[model samples]
Target chain A: MIMDDYKFLFKVVLVGNAGVGKTCLVRRFTQGLFPPGQGATIGVDFMIKTVDVGSEKVKLQIWDTAGQERFRSITQSYYRSAHALILVYDISCQPTFDCLPDWLREIEEYASSKVLRVLVGNKIDREDREIPTVVGEEFAERHNMYFLETSAKESDNVERLFMQIAEDLMKQARSRDLPRYDSNTTTIDGKTSTISDFSCCSK
Target chain B: MHFEIMDYELPTNFDVVVVGTGIIESIISAAASRIGKTVLHVDSNNFYGGLSSSFNLESFLKLNIEKRKSICMEHSSLNDTETFFPINNSDFTLDEVTHQWNITNKNKNYSDEENSAQEDIIAKEICAKKWLKDDLLKESRKFNIDLTPKVQYARGDFIELLISSNIARYSEYRSITRVLTWFNNTLEVVPCSRSDIFANNKISIIEKRILMKFFTSLDDNEDLIIKDYASKTYKCFLTDKKLSKNLIHYILYAISNSTDSTLCLEGIGNTKKFLKSLGRFGKTPFLYSMFGSGDLPQEFCRLSAVFGSVFALDQPIHGLILEENSFKSILIGKQKIKAKNFVLGLNLTPDFFLNKVKKKFISRGVFITNKSIMDSDNEPLTLLLYPAENDKNPCTVLELPWLSSCCPKDTYLVHISCNQINNPEDDLKHCVKNLFTLNEDFKAFKPLIFYSSYFSIPTNSDENVNLHDFNNLFICPGPDSELDFVTAVSKAKELFLKMYPDDEFLPRAPDPEEIKWDGDEEPSDIAQ
Candidate 1:
């Protein structure tokens, strides 16, 4: 039962252009292995993993969305409810790197204002590195995002990226857990609305 | 990743090309894709659930403001509008789209001798109802207002469709918490179930007895209740029952939901439908999606995408080519994608095809307030049916509190809709005044009018046209303003059958666990 005591559950969505190795990155973090030439994600797939941050355990519900242009509508709708967004780009593919602004535009439109954003450059193991680490860091800085570069094939910084997200979310979960006057009868969530006042809504 | 789409080898061939992402078209896309049909579902708008999607506060206001392509920066630069925003059937022209806002300034110097009104945002409008613009925009993420207002009967065709297709698994369902009717010049909760009737103190025992007897009679001897009244109005049949005024009001306006001139048999049929639907899911017969009715279409879209349907947003079909007897290709931008069959929603349809059909419209109004008309332990999702008043059509008012996920925290979004008469505001004004405090009054229990707007959308469902003009293209009508989605689902099923004469329609999709995967040598994230 020690495993079931995770205090907070956060939904983390991974989105970027295709061929950026999003599935490889997720597999490397969740299962400690990466499949070479991972196929395109069909719709979306999700997995939950618990990590201990300080004294409390946090569960990360990671959603990997299909990066193909045609599936944008399906993936974009999943953006609003996400707590963190990991925008990935490929270091070897200039086109995928060039599409960072497009990915940023989608995030700005669909995700919430307070969502934590991280910029990731995947496939750093490739010999032809079209985008430099300095450029990736600068792009992250310009957009006020946290930046990290990883290679799913080498398992370079893959676990570190997911751990950083969990730690950041744990910090968020703790701050919001602070007990104030508790005058907040109103909620932004649908859960509180359901169980609160049966008299008002129910016959 | 399905990454690296080659423009040279783009998907040019499909079995069906659905041109709109609305409820009807999305369902057809899912149905077609499920039965081994290659479907290319596209919308000119950049969002899913075209005309049926939930909207944030800022975009919702911009859509109603008309011709103002962009929100002026002087007001607020919160919404970055660089991406082109195209308003569709949900967008309406505004002759008098006006608003007044008052936000009390908290950081002002206080002097006991000086008397002054609190610092406000704006104070020019004469309307008694006003909203704080800053208050609404602050929590915009909590709101999910739908362009079309609707509910689903527990055993309704749409519910059946959702259940059978397994699209219901994609969404959370909430019972329509309550039903109210405007009776005796006041809003009252209509008791549909047996327990509700007995527990309500407003209804006398004798009245309840008579109501029960009538409902029982309808079930026990429907042949007698509906007999000899085929020619006359339902109101006449009720008058002949010698029931008290209270009992008559409950049966006619609340139970049957009939007009004064509704034929007796039709009224009886409607009442029977209502009774059978009650107690099926919850106490109420109706069910509403957790977010808005907009979620229903997206659920189908999710199902379609999982089944390998290619969806593209902001890709409008300019026109289609007809060769001999069938549609050959759809002209999107400068590219022509060939398809054997086509499905289209009846919005912004091309003039070449427009000359062959007629259209109608439904007036709609959306408002956000701080409280419900009737208070209870928690906020409720309610459907209130206001009887037709003189010189106005009857209106349906749906209220979704924060729990309904249709409004921001501490707010309820009320949607009023009716058949378009003269204009939107004119047709729905009386019902709005009956349940809401249009004028500020300290003693009134009616919810304060924090925000309100009215518009009409064109629907060509009433049009009678020969399909021979474009046999391969099936046009799904824009949603008519109504309480439930019975007609919408049935129409989708009928249209689906016309094109897919022999194929099954929307069979249940298997859950992920149910699908047998080959031996897992490598754990791909999609399979993880």
Candidate 2:
């Protein structure tokens, strides 16, 4: 396999309501800069980012699903093959926070049973936050998901969120004693894994 | 499990109100929304795809058992397979499907007659154990059976639409591993690509040269060969080429994929389509979805939502407010949602408009078989065209080996579709017997049919792309009984342009990372 050097190629999907900063969270984490006033994502778009996890090169194929009620089927289709599901909601919007249960329900239906999950509260830089950090943490705890708050606008916890997902995916793969995904042609949740040279982690 | 009831209210006004989430309506919804139109897409069923959906094994079985109110269905067995199994609608719900193996006792008998247990045929050569009904029921969720079985011509409109709309990223496709033709009472792989033709040992060296010459003639159509047989049938055209009977059969059934009565022009056109489609993605000229065909409609629906199109499933438009040959508003349950343009699936077309339109039914059968029709080392995604037998029409069979994730491991999901002739069973039974075994023929080299269902789907035959009052309301036809999406895409494109004459149709949507987040700087003219 050409991607033998990379320790893991994880397919992580981001799903939430519209205007919840799902795209912003992906942008800030992968690009280190968040563009404000981003428009709605049409369909599901993805990006490739390689991160360092304890000297292991982990490439993340992050799928950013459009956060609209109409796209539930499309987003749910991605869930079945995902290694990790990042359920994001805006911290400043009450409706987005309230919709976490729906998102969790989606994960229950479409996601693989062994998929690692993370709850993200995005747009935390906004001062007028409607949902508290405790509220998000409690909800995540109830669903048995790892929780974190991020400000894609300020780039706070954005990097940590993805790094933790990569690390956790590796940890989960190890604990389950599942075969390591080193094959360049291996499909994680049906999407082809990308093989690359020295990752950005080395840089 | 059901989704948490989403408290979504319909937008009071929308640029387009699309009902029925079939491929056609879904594409129109996405195309309209891609251009920034306020779109409201809804389906009567709880799921995304109304007719062209991929259901899990249980749901698919239940759909076959449970009678659909909106869509008409009829099936019956004839000739040798006279036994009929009727699904009592009350026995099963939409979510759960039930089936028990009736051959466990037969296993003991067959094995007792030979060496050991031999009821299950698929597991004999591959493994030591036999597959039981419980094994299939346990892994039912893995199956994604399409209601309308179809494949994408590698370069067909559907593929072009997916790539152009940037929705192709949402799904994955594997090229059909082989194109098989039913010949000499067995299936033989057709040499499609140039490499396959050159390497196929089945054709003699002399025959290979003749086939290659014919293929090269079909390459660009610059030769005067087709013009000479312009008015004759494609069969005549092939005979004029001095090709052998085997070569002629391969050309008619596999290459051109047209009927014997097909004109020389249309036959050559189909041959060109087939030839041009090869090697675009792989050795075969077809691409089957890695998941299932239903993923396509959902991708389009996703594109619509990315543009902020409001979507609601299980919401049926009960009435339409028509004023002077134009629709003003639609009544969904209790809410009145107004839209400038209304696009609806033919099955869901308001009876007022559909009063005069003729309806045609496409015969379909979904079977979960234990082995591939033509077993090979790697499970193949195969497309088999069984020529019309007796009174039945030509049947197109699609085999999604377990690797396609449309069925459980060690099981192949086969869908047989054709133009309805009286009953679906009669129309498809001959073809089913050709590829699979119905009775307990232990040694016959045919895929064992674990379970099967037959139904007929009603589609509009109207080639008059527009309805009489289509100025404001457009009716998109349900799936036609074709192996490709050329008809559906052209239909969707025509409807889209009628709704938005000035805007680019499904312009390429750029990746989100390609667009800068610079405030006040509008994203490029890429499909927003």
- Assign candidate 1 its CAPRI class: incorrect
DockQ of 2: 0.16
lDDT of 2: 0.72
Clashes of 1: 8
B-chain TM-score, every candidate?
0.85, 0.86
Off by over 4 Å in 1: A1-11, A26-62, A66-68, A71-76, A112-117, A134-147, A154-203, B1-10, B64-131, B223-242, B276-283, B348-358, B438-445, B518-528
Predicted structure 1, TM vs. truth: 0.80
With candidate 2 superimposed using the best TM-score fit, by how many Å does residue A153's alpha carbon deviate from the native?
Answer: 7.4
Model 2 lDDT, residue B241, Cα: 85
Which is the leading candidate under lDDT? 2
Which 10-residue window of candidate 1 chain A scores lowest in summed lDDT? Answer: A179-188
Candidate 2 lDDT, tens digit per residue, A85-133?
A: 8888888778778877877776776676678889899877887888989
Candidate 2 C-alpha lDDT tens digits along B315-360: 6456556555567777775666788998877665554444554557
Write the residue-wise lDDT of candidate 1 on A52-125 in tens digits: 88888888888766433534565445664578889989898788888789888878866766788999999888
